[model samples]
Target: RVIPAQAALFAHVWLDPQNPPRAIMLQYYRDGWMHRAVWGDYDVIPWGAANTTERVHQGELPALGEWTRLEVPVEQLGLNTGDALTGFALTQFGGHVAWDQVSIRGTSDPANDPLRSFAAWWRSVAGKDTPGLSGELADLAKRGPQAEASVEARRRLLNHYLINVCADTQRSLAQPKAELARLQAERTALEASIPSTFVYRDLDQPRDAFVMLRGAYDKPGEGVQPAVPAVLPPLTATGANGRATRLDLARWLVAPEHPLTARVTVNRFWQQVFGTGLVKTSYDFGSQGEMPSHPELLDWLAIEFQRSGWDVKQLMRLLVTSNAFQQTSQVSPELLARDPENRWYARGPRLRLDAEQIRDNALFVSGLINLTMGGKGVKPYQPENIWEPVGFAGSNTRFYTQDHGDALYRRSIYTFIKRTAPAPFLSNFDAPNREQFCTRRERSNTPLQALQLMNDVQHVEAARELAARMLREGGDSAESRIAWAYRLLLTREPAAEELAIVQAQLTAHTNRYAADLAAAQQLIGNGESKPDATLPADTLASYTLVANMLLNLDETLTRN
Candidate 1:
């Protein structure tokens, strides 16, 4: 959580009366300043109180109920294997309550745990399951020693060990002070056997690498020294005085004399603003790549980038805020006939929000976003199962330890990136696969995406939370609630027809769930509840269904 730089204290308790976390220590990743860590779900104690011997920061009252970052170790909490921290409740205790991204992990190898493994398996089974039949595991006989059984047993054991190792304590290796010192000296002596640098001769003489026959060291073919491509002008040996090095290569690529540099830069800028560059192949200037539609313009921008000291922010700002970029994406038949792809930037790009932007925008407008900037990578909320390693690769489970909610809502650019398991929402919206050179991304439309918008748990929760916030922030009138929803979702006042539709929708839902205020409130899944009877499970599901409809509308998904 990226908290405001305000004077506040935060605290956490692993063991509480009503909802004690399965783990003992809450290892808080907070820095001591404006931020602090807080905990919740202590039903036995007063709403804002808990029993714990942990030290609180001095001169400040703890932000007991408010969501804040804190650290607790398992040894202190007394929870062993098979336990888990289900949730944390943030309370302001009669103060402003703001909470954002929250997640839990073990002090050690938490990613390998069984519950998470099960969750991943559940996610992989796409579509509805058969009403009575179990999936893969159910198909296997209860008692068997077949090859498939062996694999399944291995998986079960691995998951079991993960949970046990994380939750259970075990004897750790330790050494006496004198013996430890002796071992350190011995290890140092062993390390001294290897040289700091590799034993090799510098290629002092000018030599070019030959194509190795059979990839064997002794089987060198015709030499091909470093030089500019034949299609481009020949390289002059002046810069390195006839020697070749990476510096010389970089200089050649960036030199104004080079034909592709300026052209590539400008085209990329155009693509960034209008969704398609002049050349369409921004990085590739090879013969196989597309030719620039506006060659002159491409050269112009490239030159400009160099002249501006490669100021990326300056270039982006100019492009995004321009009339060309901002033009309404209302399709005109005549314009479409003239330029269907909008190659000339006659109209702005009408693109669906990229994954991170989609999540960020929803969270931001709903008033839940914390805007802390830059730090170690924090884990974006993910479905519990998605972190599992399928077969070969190790788990890529690096996550951030945020001090406050603001850090969680910082722009996705600063989000921690892992080579394996990039956030799903971002990937769904065509985030570049990190494995390759991603000069451009494929804009794909698929049913999987539609399903995600309709049913992904996170979006459903956001919708409910935002809806509740609209109700709370708006006045008592339904009109006020409708207005607030419009402002939050569309960032503008609702049109008269739009207001009428919203009124009808809200009224219908209100009446339908009149007997169950809890049901109506549950429509927003933030877990905050209003005092009322619970609605039928189906009624709450209806609210989500309606929210999904809203999310799927062309207007909601598209940028104008």
Candidate 2:
């Protein structure tokens, strides 16, 4: 092959991180001589040249452990436009290297390019061109392939050519594409407008059930049938075929005589309200699991749950209204020593709220929560580029675009979840990514959780909104405002000492903000919502700090 003028040779290469190649060498045979270019970690070569006629160009190595496109102009490798390139070789010394897409590309004249010609024809036929499209064309022409235009610039030019310059084939297919899109949209609308549910039906000729030998599906040993465990009650119900069906299984699970279903359901609900279930191992009910701390209470609750027809709301009401649930969480030193984990149920539930509850609580107190019911998931504030590393390039969820207005303030239940990259604010507080079923979430207390409360955009904005509410609705004096916030956050009036401490904090913040209004404005300018322009910035900012402090208090976060 003959070398073309203004052509560059490029190859996508990946080097091993643990054992990278000592050197990468590209050799071109021209005019009976081998011209070589080398890139390696060392500045000078440790080995002498194989032949006196060989020409070498030494360069530095690129990054290791990632695929990178490396390109070099043929002219830089001592090749002329008319030179005959008989062969080329890539050589590596030591370790391993992988290469792909190795080829030579030549510069194309902008005037003769197909895309430019199509654009000119489209402009003459359409009689107009958008400013953006025209600008991209001009930029591409100015920085042609010879000038090494960037990949992004080339992509933009191609997009403009496809969107703005319609060829004969494109014009022919436009109507059909539009019609297909309309039909798809109509189908989607019809699907959403109707209600649907899943119903199980037995096959006419059901497949034989076999017990796999050593859990290998292909190695079957013995046949089996659909029936309850031998230890429990039998499944007597049958289908039209005279065999037990899925409905029979369902009946057996919820039967009044069954031992596990009602007990497990009530225990989970109890765990939801309290921190732990009576049976500490909620996922396991076998002999291997821990026994219930109070067997009689468990039995009674399960019986009551079954009697109420498994009504979850009624069960919740009954539990919450009980005297045991209403007991004070405060414990004496002796009691704390006797039962550190409260396994004896001597006190009420007192633990930090879960991730969703904590976020929703903040939004509720700040009055920023949007009470809209039923919609698609929403995107809330999260750290920038949190999804880039774990996300696929062409995936719809690769980019995390924060939503605006009400979407930003929706309940945490409506927050969009990406299995690869869960919301950072929630994850920092122990929210699962939801890749698999989670029976119990592990709670951890760390400085990072406190940092999220004070610094995250959502929490900071919530604090600002709460501050504004306190200023506008609370009484004029500082004491009144402090008392009002205390009541609103904790559902009780502040103690005299607590009130005095808050007053001192407010006074100190007010003096500092009063001196530096710029800092105060910066502090309040956190979220999409604007601060109250009518109120003084310094005063609002001072109160915002105080509100933030109140939101982060242990008492406020605890469930009791």
Candidate 3:
């Protein structure tokens, strides 16, 4: 909405123990997009020199810390009358030029403004959308020199201005209170009038499909109609015109007669809850894919799933609540030798949590979880300049600013996922780049995963907060507190041997923290969550060490 007509850029800058030379460029954007032509480069060339001029000031600039005003006039720069000016940009390049109190000023020009009052009032007077309202408004702006000539013409434009913009009240420059209130009402009504629905359109004649020779882009083949593969179920008529469509293909895939339909559906859901799909290769169910480990069990589950009208939640509930799912994960040597991957359902599901769940679990156990479900993705704690080093300069991830307060602790699913630069810990743990459908996520064991669990900022913060809770809420003795932590984190009490091991680690860490109070203080207060001021640094630090070990354990990272 800025009118840069006769406008000027001004800024106060100070350079003391700083770089000797710096240049400021005045860049302009049409609307908001900036390009080579609109950059308006070489607008202001200020430097430290021993001289003086009328428009330029220079006299052996003060060596001590001192502020100097730099200005650039719009006339001197190449500014177009048609340039619907967006904003001013001041960029300093050289060693360093610290700036303060920057501004751009100019007399208003209605032609360059975004909100055309004349256009708005014309539309209101016309009582409907019309081409003349816009065409006449454009004609008025072009009457630059002749604008103030005709009295009647001036009055018409003035009336339009008053009705659409602000009333030209001489009493005050600011908008009157009553008019402001009316503005709020109008805005509310306008917002409410906007329909909240979506419409999709289809072509009257659907486009024909063709196969490329050897999948070559340039080679063309005979046109084909919408179809399913010959090897799969034959498609049925679903579209209005009765020709089989992609939608028809979808319907045919789920038809009861299709042999692979229900079986594949149940197998994918089983994989989600039980670590491995029954077919092993969920993406491929043809002869090329792995055969089902328990074919009869797969068939029975598929039949039940289909009978329930494809009730996904009910199927999942039934699967998890079954007797077979609750068995202990531990395996005897003979069973391990017979079925290495436990394909025969010999044991309960036991595998590392998915990338998202790993972070969610840490937040959940620490009581720092933001349970708010489904919203815009949030930026969580990430290493500084992590994106910069990799040339990730997208709008969302140019500079990773960690969200504050509860947002900083939201579920990992809400973490701002940039395709170019995924969250480090999640990416390290094999989270996908998401360019295509993620049929499977391969799990990897690496030093990065271990390091992240022990030292990533969020994980460290979770450990500290969890340790604080353990110290304040857990029983007095170290053994009792360790046992309490185990139950809270894992939903089960630790064995006697596990308790003894953690207890020993706590005693060793206590001595280590007691020897260095400063190191202990840093560990106890690692994140935004305020540390328990009541607990001694040594106590929290000792427990943080034990908590760190507990979080890094295979049992904590895996779901069993």
lDDT of each: 0.56, 0.82, 0.73
Top model number, lDDT: 2
Kindly list the per-residue Cα lDDT of model 2 for residues 299-357, writing each as its tens digit.
99999999999999999998889887889999999999999999998999898899999
Candidate 3 segments whose C-alpha is farther than 4 A from its true place: 1-200, 216-219, 238-241, 307-309, 389-394, 491-497
Of 1 and 3, the candidate ranking higher by TM-score:
3
* Decoy 3 TM-score against native: 0.64
lDDT of 1: 0.56
> lDDT tens digits, residues 1-560, model 3?
34345776566767545564434443555554231111112334432121222123222333436777766564444444334455655555454556677666676555434344454333333333323335555455445424444666656656545554643442453557568889999999998988678655556787766888899878879877777678776788766677676666777877887888899889988998888898999999987999988899999998898899999999999988987788888999999999889888889988888889988888888889999999888988888777766564466457767789889988887888777778887889988886667878889999989988888878888998889888878888888788889888887898989888888888899999999999999987788988888889998999988888888888888878
Which stretches of candidate 1 lie above 4 Å from their native place? Answer: 1-208, 212-219, 230-241, 391-410, 415-420, 472-476, 517-552
Which one wins by lDDT: 2 or 3? Answer: 2
Cα error, residue 490 of model 3, in Å, equals 3.8
Q: Candidate 3: minimum summed lDDT over ten consecutive residues — where?
A: 33-42
- Candidate 2 deviant stretches above 4 angstroms: 1-189, 192-201
Tell me each candidate's TM-score.
0.56, 0.65, 0.64
Report the poorest 10 consecutive residues by lDDT, candidate 1.
1-10
